[model samples]
Target: MVVTATRTALASADVLADVSVVDAETLARSGAVSLADVLVHLPGVEMTRNGGPLGTTNLYLRGGNTNHTVVMIDGIRIDTQSGSGGATCQAIPVGQIERIEILRGPAAAVYGSDAVAGVVQVFTKGGQDGFTPSVGVGVGSQGTRTLTAGVRGAEAGWRYALALGRETSEGYNIQPAAYPDRDGYERNTASLRLGKDLAPGHRLDATWVYSDADAGYDSTTSKSSANYAKDNRALQRLSALGLSWQAKWSDVWSTRVMVTRADDRYATLPAPGAVPSYNTQTQVDTVLLHNRWNWREAVWTAALESRQDRLSNAGTQPRDTSRTQDALALGYGAKSGAHSWQVNARLDDDSEFGQYTTGALAYGWAFAPSWRLTASVGTAFRAPTLYQRFSEYGFAGLEPEKARNREIGLKYSQQGHEFAVVAYQNRVSNLITFSGAGACASSFGCYANTARAKLQGVTLSGATHMAGVVWTASLDVQDPVDVATGKRLARRAQRLLKLGAETGWQTWGLKADLLLSGDRYDRVTDARPLLPGYGVLNLSATKALTPNWSLLLRMDNVGDKYYETARGYATAGRTAFVGLTWTGR
Candidate 1:
């Protein structure tokens, strides 16, 4: 397996830094079978799921808001809808990913808005020399089954690829219920990529992708009702179209321009006696231009971007709004001897939230052949979403969330062994909250600055390869507190752990993984006990049956661990499945 962590002018292999790269092979071995499943097992990461196969899986990284984590595909932001702030990582299917590159720590200096937590970049697979056809089928616990197929190839001066996948499963309890779990889901997704060599020094690439999903949600947990079989339904649909052109104009300068558009529709229908269903349709369009220049030992990167969004909501309360934003960033970095230094600044002007500036500065020094030290300090800000700013019984003066962070880390890598640890603190102000979303009579105030939070944490992750086997582990310790009340914040755990190993022997493969999460208070002010510590185990094996085909098998949550990350939700139990894969050149 090979990890593609970063892509720069000088892209190198075997990088030693604060990062985690998941290769295609490793993804399959985990038996995660879903985007959210893969991330939950990573350190410092937690997920919230409504209940079902394609449920609303929201990710919280390093104690940051769900919208503070950026999702990118091939270096381009794929998230849409300013109201949602950020797209759900779980919306993307794993079958189309070639590799996943995760950059940890503050990245607002590079990306923007959502980089407060970090960045997850997904790169889709491309074509080889000849057409390759592949298919896979898996059946596991809870009446689960998945089927996927795809073809890839290169012809003429253009390379083209396509993939289609479908997945379904009868999900788990989600919460203690009066009846057996009655949640399940179905999804259909397809993606296409085409690249053309326009000139000796220029190229063009285009991608079109679409997904439609019908998923069930166990909405009973929200109410005190013991009738858990009452599951709502969610319909999610997304379509994206993008085009990019890259050209090398000279030895010292190069440029790339991209235009992208996305249409997203989300709807939730009540089950039986629930409130009337609601639906939201959002459209996002963006254009970005990036240019880089290298002058001797120093390099500069600058980008200009603009985005426009409009959303329409239908149901009990109808509303609509449109906003536009323009942003620009400039970064300078240089390498001298064994030290590297970087500085970046960015400015964003939003139609609804005024303007804000964010930036970062960092230094990396190599004192020894195999040891390096990095230190960074940065300031970042997130504009209040339209919903947070102007929803319902309005609070017109709400401020954007803001934070300042500082960190220092060390890295060491020799032979195939590597390790890194970073300690960081982020002081946040004006953290936005919807506590005021509670229904209010016409004469009462509905929104106000009700709370504030502080997040301090240390993250440690490492990987080692020895005797033809690779081992990896990560741990996160976080203390999230409500500064207003001097108490611990809600839904923030104190400890998180993950460990995994993979080995291959003469045409056979073996892998195992473990995930453990500690307990936390369910409410900040009330201090109610919620979830407890729990562990889950996953195992997989694969064997080559022929020159062009292989057989694979997996068991997920093998321990049948019963626990809830969310206050009232229960997770899935043990499940098993098998698949077949074929590759070609």
Candidate 2:
């Protein structure tokens, strides 16, 4: 089942949207500590990181800007109103996640704002019928170590789950030209979920997650002075809490009320003993009331949402600023025989930017057995972040970014075989960019709505299981361009290809993955030359030692390929990890 695409639960095979789902089993086998690394394996998804695992990271979906995507953890919206306004991917822990869903294209029609690109929903571990306890320890290359423990259970109409994890790594020098020093990184994570069944048709739930991390990097703007090198470290923390009530009044009527809060804190340590700089804190609070009516072959949904974003920065001019948005949304879905359709509409009122409305329509036709064709059209928008409007380089008159999208897809699924081909075109107006210093209080630059973008792409993917082996492949060809400059978007490759195979031999299970990409430019201004294309391979194996124990061995970048996702940043390079896991029998 999938719910992110339409804001309601439904069979994934019949949904008219382009979406992907990932389970816990696949995540564990990948051995990826960073959410950015795992998301890159999905079709048309790409990411760039500055230095180590806990470094500043950004994810681009279908060629959209990093801030265009919306992220949620268990029902809580998690985003930062500072630093260009986007979700902090490095703060999420892979060890605590149970499932993930990716919804492609504009989703502002279903969700209110900041859904101009897509949406990523993460579900953490939850309680089962009985107590289940687990523990794991792992060691990897580069002086890396990890420890994790979790427990979940249900008893007497009460359910609870808890998870804790820690990871540390001795990273490599990202910029040997200026600062030849080893960068280090460390992180701690925790998650909790509690629930109670009040009656046959009512329930209550509470969820929370916290992450704290520190990472080292090098900063050198000039080579004229070797003393300019500084061992900079980034300090970051994120926490989210969600509470909800779900009631099924009858077979045809259901309702949910939820409230959530998220906090993000960030700072910089110029040196080992220097005082932290650029300290900032961002807080978001949200409330939602949702109603659904399920009757025969049709479903209807309505939602009322309210959100508040506040930012406190010791470095910015204003020091403190805030904004609010309230929205109402309506949706409908129905299926008759082999035909299905979905419609959504939303209206938003912002305290600073006034009002806006968006809508979407999607249709699907099952013309033959195990085959479906889909088409969709939608519109979306994103409000400017508080930092972009009240900081030293801010412009209070900047308009919200807007977008329109159209797409079509064909899919076939049966048994253990699945295939899909999708094509889409999205255009964005009032795109924000940093321009000359004349319009703002700062002499360096100011944020302005002086750009436009065009993102068009085609993606092909397939998977099949045969002879105890599973094969998966996907290819993406895209054109992401700046309409004003006619140059391609920075760090986005025009072509990407990925392949994977999994099988079992006796008690051992094995897997392999390969990724390839085309050449890309480092900046939209063409200030630097084009970066060359690259490929990397990864392999892993798992074995069951006993009824309650398992062993895992994984190797990444098996070829030791030297590549850079960003111009001055460093990749993880070749690394190996081995782990032992234990579970209560």
Candidate 3:
């Protein structure tokens, strides 16, 4: 079941929003080390990463800004008030995740602020009905090595899960033009979850996850020269905790109360020094009360949320700031005969930004036996982060960014064959952008609302099971531009095509896929320098040696393709991985 679309569990086919779900099995088969790698394969998603998997990573959903997409762990939001004002994708441990739900349009009506583009919710692995233990080891290109062990079990109305993982890689020269050095990265992760049924209709759950990474990168600062190397590295930590109590009053009503906290920390130090040249930390705390009711054939939802964002910068120019938001949201959904409808509304009152409201309306019609058409319209807004308004180079008067989106979709589904076509246009005003100093102390740039954007796109996707194989494909054509300049958004391609095929032999399961992307602007400062398009092919296969053991092989970038998502940073050209897993079933 997917809950991101309307803040309540619903079948994927019954949802009116454009959405996708990726399970743990898919993640394991993708042979990806980071969340960013897996996201790029989804429809209407674009990624930009500096250096390698352990670099500054950003995801653009439906041509929105990096911060426009709201990321949640379990049911808690994870956003930073420092450094780009978004979640740190590089710090999330892929091995600990059980599933991911992605919504590809405005979702501020369900989630509170900072969902101008959409929402992504990640669920960690938890205990099932039986005891299960697993251990896996892998070796990959660039001297990469990985080890993971996990266990899940349930007994006597109690459930528990524990997972641990570690990975290290010897990377290549990330930015040779600035400083020539072999960048490397190391990460360690751990996760824990526990749940208990206190009564016949009451239950409680708690979860915690933590990861730390040290990654190498070349700095563009004046501390390094073309002939000299400072050997810069970033130390990062990400952690999240969630506690919830769920109660079912009757067959028609249920309520849940949850509290969650997340923290993001980064310290960039040069020359392996004891002191960090730059250090910052951001923490988010949230409390939510959600209620759902089913009457007749309709579903109703109401929720109340309070969130706080805090930022701290420790150094010679130390600073600390915080802000809060309180919100109330309501939603309704119904399916009668061949027509379905969904509506949602939310109001957020920020400590600094006063009040803002958002709403969404969607309708679906089953015109034919196996065909459905959907139309939706929504509004969203994002308040400025604390760092953007209180830092040395910040503008105190920065305003919230606002957007309105309209979309239509047509779909056909029968048995295991499915196809869809969706078209969307989003117009954003009061867009927060960095420009010449605006009443700030720094000579560099400061954040301000000085731009408008138009993001329009079309997506065609299909999946089918035929001839003993499953095939899936998607194509995206988008034009994301600045209203005044008419220049395309940096690092966004105009066209992208992805194709995949999977099959199972007598003893082996095999998969193959390809990616083709169009050209893009190298930098946001200018669109003159265009980065050429490129294609990459990947292959994977798994063999069951025994009931308890299995072997996996994967080859990425099989054609040795060369491409760059960012101008100076080099991409991982080619890579191969082999793994062995032992499961106690």
**How do the residues 76-110 of candidate 1 rate in per-residue lDDT, one tens digit apiece?**
56564434457756567788877787766667666
Q: Indicate which candidate wins on TM-score.
A: 2
> Order of candidates by TM-score, top first?
2, 3, 1
Global fold similarity of model 3 (TM-score) = 0.97
Superposed Cα deviation of residue 172, candidate 3 (Å): 1.5
Clashes of each: 1, 0, 0
Q: Write the per-residue lDDT of candidate 2 for residues 402-429, one digit (tens) a residue.
A: 9999999999999989999999999999
lDDT score, candidate 1: 0.73
Better of 1 and 3 by lDDT: 3
lDDT of 3 at 239: 91
Model with the higher TM-score, candidate 1 or 3:
3
Prediction 2 TM-score vs. true = 0.98
Off by over 4 Å in 1: 1-17, 80-84, 222-229, 315-318, 437-449
Judge candidate 1 at residue 551 and give its lDDT. 82
